[model samples]
Target: MGFLSSLLGIIGFGIGLPIGLLVGFFFFVYSKPKQVQDPVVRPLEECDTTVLPDLLPEIPIWVKDPDYERAICREIRRQAEPILAEYSEKYKIKAIEFENLDLGTLPPTINGIRVYETNEKELVMEPVIKWAGNPNIILVLKLLSLQITLQLVDLQVFFAPRMTLKPLVPTFPCFANILVSLMERPHVDFGMKVLGGDIMSIPGLYQFIQVVRAFKLMKADFLGLSDPYVKLNLTGESLPGKKTTIKKKTLNPEWNENFKFVVREHQSQALQIQVFDWDKVGGDDRLGMQLVPLKLVTPHETKEFNLDLLKHTNISVHNDKKYRGTIVLELTYAPFREDSTSALSAKFDQMDSIIYRSSSNETLSKAGLLSVLVEAAEDLEGERHNNPYALILFRGEQKKTKLLRKTRNPLWNEEFQFALEEPPLLDKIRIEVLSKRTGIRFRSKESLGHVEINLDDVVRNGRINQKYHLINSKNGQLHVEIEWTMV
Candidate 1:
């Protein structure tokens, strides 16, 4: 009876253990939570590390508010003020004022934006930004007695990567990422100039002319005894060609015509002379021609040319060995000199007596102080807009007046001083009125008019307050006063 009972208990234990294992497996599978995901958003910095981003994200709706615009302006000023302070501290300029900053042609806007993926590491955006507007930036800088106004429009700004933001200055941090991306490409071009114009632009100096006095041409025409004339032309110059009167029925014709040409740039100038035979029925026949360069002649020296005329192919005469004709002319060149147009000639008309007086005594030579007072100007040339300013140059030193905006007339009552070691008789002062172009892409200076004042007249009169006419212009006059004091 005991053995029978043990067998039945073992069978029951095995069945119970198997059932317990099955129940625990089903519970583990049903109780665990399912894996879930949330939507992802990436900032501009999260663009792919290996690939460059081609799209810009849309601006948020909040950025379009007027309050945001004001904030941006405030931030720009706050950043710029410290930089300007550094410049002022350098002492190159005395004081500076940052007056106004406003939107230019086009405003800022954003099109749209989108995000994808669960990694929160990448995003694609479509941003529309048209930075077309005239941003007004009025900068007033005080240097000496001059009050200069620099109007900067359409300001383009950029930021470099790894730049640090100073403390206490409010800024838009989002722009930092955008500006950094822009650093990958070049944006601006820098240029520098040492001098304004050529040496001919100096005051008091003059350019003389080269005069050619032609006499006659001998046997110029290939055909026998043809009516001939001489024509003088300036190669590479726009001046009218000079011609001699036609001599009827003569192989050797005499002209006695004088032709003069200004020697502006001597190296690029040449004289061309052509002899032509007159015809009653058909076109005139070419006899011969010769070209002479202006650089071969010395200044203030007279030279003679009896050149043999040749054809366009450099051939004198194809059939006749003695078909050559010579042209006789006297060439004289008078170049610029310091005393050429100097008013000193008018002041010391009796140069011989003055030289004798100076040799007699050296005590008459005394140093003095020179004063120039610039008053105003009127009838300046302009079309669309004009920002006129005055530039004064003396002995290679230069100074400027404040800019006057949008006017045909400008007033600048300014004073300047110079200490002379010698007499002011030899010096000349140049004053140029220029119009400043404020366009962002087109920044240049247009000359309104200019005047050169000889100091000899000012020294002789002690003080000269008069209106001077502008050069190379029909209208415009400048008022100025000069005084010389013996110190």
Candidate 2:
């Protein structure tokens, strides 16, 4: 009994000693008070305050279809209300009273406007509000976060006739850059919470969802012994193309390759597959190319297709006649659809009888308008004194800006409007900046440099305001903005 008692004491000491030391150290280190620093507060300035004047109002916009615009505004408010409710609770703010909120009063401008109605990332538009009257009014008024989404399936949105907000600051002078969305159509949104670390819980942003497609590059019946490999592209910007592993020296090479692409809209885009023959000596030889329209795919269902590879031809031939070989492919579109109680619950009509549905076709065909603002050009290279003028081309319609004389950098803040029923999304908008001749005749025009922008980018991104690198030159860039409106 004495030995057992002594042994128990030793065991208890062994265990308790270490634990006591650990606890002592933890409290000794963590129990100390932390120094809290006072936050620096900056006073708001009044006089000479640079207000980003509503750029939308300066450009007068006309909407032909008032009913369509009203429908879009109604949908936008519906989707935004619940989102505002969540924001109000999370931020501990007063209940957002949208009973007085009307689409007729919302600002109709492209300034700080973003559409979050695709399978893309969750759109959080932060509109900064400036107090025009009582500074202390900020304490009483709670600023709510605005999230914009489209209620349509095809992911189309009407952005004209911007809504105005007046009741939010009826007593106080408050200016907020409210972000709202007016939608038309949608594609696929599975409402995924995490995709490769992306939070795509939203209903409509295209980037939130992805499509998995498999290509069975079964036997290429080429004329020669070629090491065949396949390259896939989404056919928009110069995104890096995907390629399959090269199969060794056989004309009939079978390459089963799988690839994934982020889809924006259904019928507005296509996947371009180009087969090339691998070579050790020189550049890879072009075997054949084929295009698969994205509109043919159904969400959550796998479909197989035998696509015929077509040889390069100057004349346009039907897909049946154009042949190099056939590629057996399988594709599945995985979209993220948020469950009920989510911010967006837009019911879209399934696409039926709509052939070649695109922003140019389904939405823009009836009443479509395109506005191109030619802002400026920088770092142009060529002669010492170059008089630069811009030639803009879309489909068959062409417009030119007034010439800016004898300057390497030209600033022509000009806007051109294109009235159209259907726009060709596959075609490129050609912009060529030319310099008038200075010599004896001085009548001929010289191509300083040119920029070709894919119209699909303009259609997808709502408004494109960026500088494009000039082609056929080492250095030069053109600043341009494109806005699309559907009446």
Candidate 3:
């Protein structure tokens, strides 16, 4: 009797479970809410325009800010089609075109614009852009044997960018260049659908989108529509300034060039940058110029500048009206070592004591090393064969460089050292360029050019790198670097 009752109970439970499940499914499918309202629809022509004012309170905070401005969505959509088509072609697609492209009526908003007030001739503004747009952009792509449709929906982007309009002038469209850079990583969110199925809805795909969307903003800077080169030098020095290679026939050129200069007094010295448009026939035109004071930079640290190009160093009301573009560069100042600085200080103190004790008419002498580096000679023409060499003559001591055979421009890069008991303040060094022929000619040797350089400036400035014109030769120049270091 007990076994039969248990079997009957199990059979009744199995039958009731299915019946209950079917009843619940039926109610769930047929159930209706207690409250139901139909969505209101209106025709586009009959829509009331005055209702926009009532909806102002529901707008975003960026829309209410006075500094915020709406982005031109229509123009952006128009310009993006060709760029997208080009990108599709790059991927070897047979045909790709935008069937529907609209950024929608709700444009991207600038949260706020912060303008900086600086003494320099640049206008800097930082704008925060926040966009949560309902865009309908669809692209139709045709591969070799297949066609696909892609749709973009529910897009959002947020970023802060620094915009700079440099060298403000009085003319129309006052700024010469516009530079844009991202301040931080951008945030982008969107939904992408392919063939009526959302591909972005796949698991673990959003993380990849995050990485792909992180990118930098491109700068809108412009250069002169000519060949451009840069000359960099330190002020108060007669050095042959360092030069960058010329870029040909390009309005926008990039020269990631580096240079170093010997700084005597960082407090008073300044860096001068001169940009010129290269011309093969005549003199190069002056594109722009700027001066950066060394005192503004901290030693041992690198600093960057986007300096606005100017007519000259002397800033005036009239010159401010000229727009000469801009230059971007990095500068670093490295001072002498601690031991060298202490040794230099002791030498200066000893010189001061000697000046106080000695008579004013007596000559003061200090032991130092004089280094003369003959780099090269340019445009050297000898009356005979042009196998050129350089001769350096100091206080009755002469040093000569290796003779290079048959070259108008010879690079010797030779260094000569002279241990001197006194600075060559009142003295002069004579450098002569002479050529010797290998075979017997009318004259075996001939003088190309010679120059006599005074040593007063080198003694005062510690170093001088300059190209001096030859005294007797036409269109000849000698490159020399002289350094006076305390022993």
Q: What TM-score, over all chains together, does every model reach?
A: 0.30, 0.31, 0.30
Output the lDDT of residue 228, model 2: 78
Top lDDT model: 3
lDDT of 1 by residue, 288-337 (tens): 77788877777657777777766643445464444456777778755422
Model 1, runs deviating above 4 Å: 1-223, 313-322, 338-487
lDDT tens digits by residue: candidate 2, 1-487: 9999999999999999999999999999989788999997554344232222231233212232335655765676789778878866754555544323233333423323322243432334322221111111000123345221221122212222223442243232242333444221111111111101111232221211122222333343355466777787775634566678887766556665566555545557777777887878778877777777776877667777776667753246544463466666777664532222112223222222211123323443433356788877878886645889999987786789888777777767677766454554566889999888666665467788898888776654345677888997678899887765433
Indicate the residue-level lDDT of 41 in model 3.
80
Runs of candidate 2 with Cα error greater than 4 angstroms are: 1-223, 313-323, 340-487
Candidate 3 accuracy as TM-score: 0.30
Quantify all predictions' global Cα lDDT against the true fold: 0.59, 0.55, 0.67
Candidate 1, residue 311: how far the Cα is off, in Å: 1.0
- Residue pairs in clash, model 1: 104-133, 104-134, 105-132, 105-133, 105-134, 106-132
Q: Give residue 361's error in model 1 in angstroms.
A: 25
Poorest 10 consecutive residues by lDDT, candidate 2: 130-139
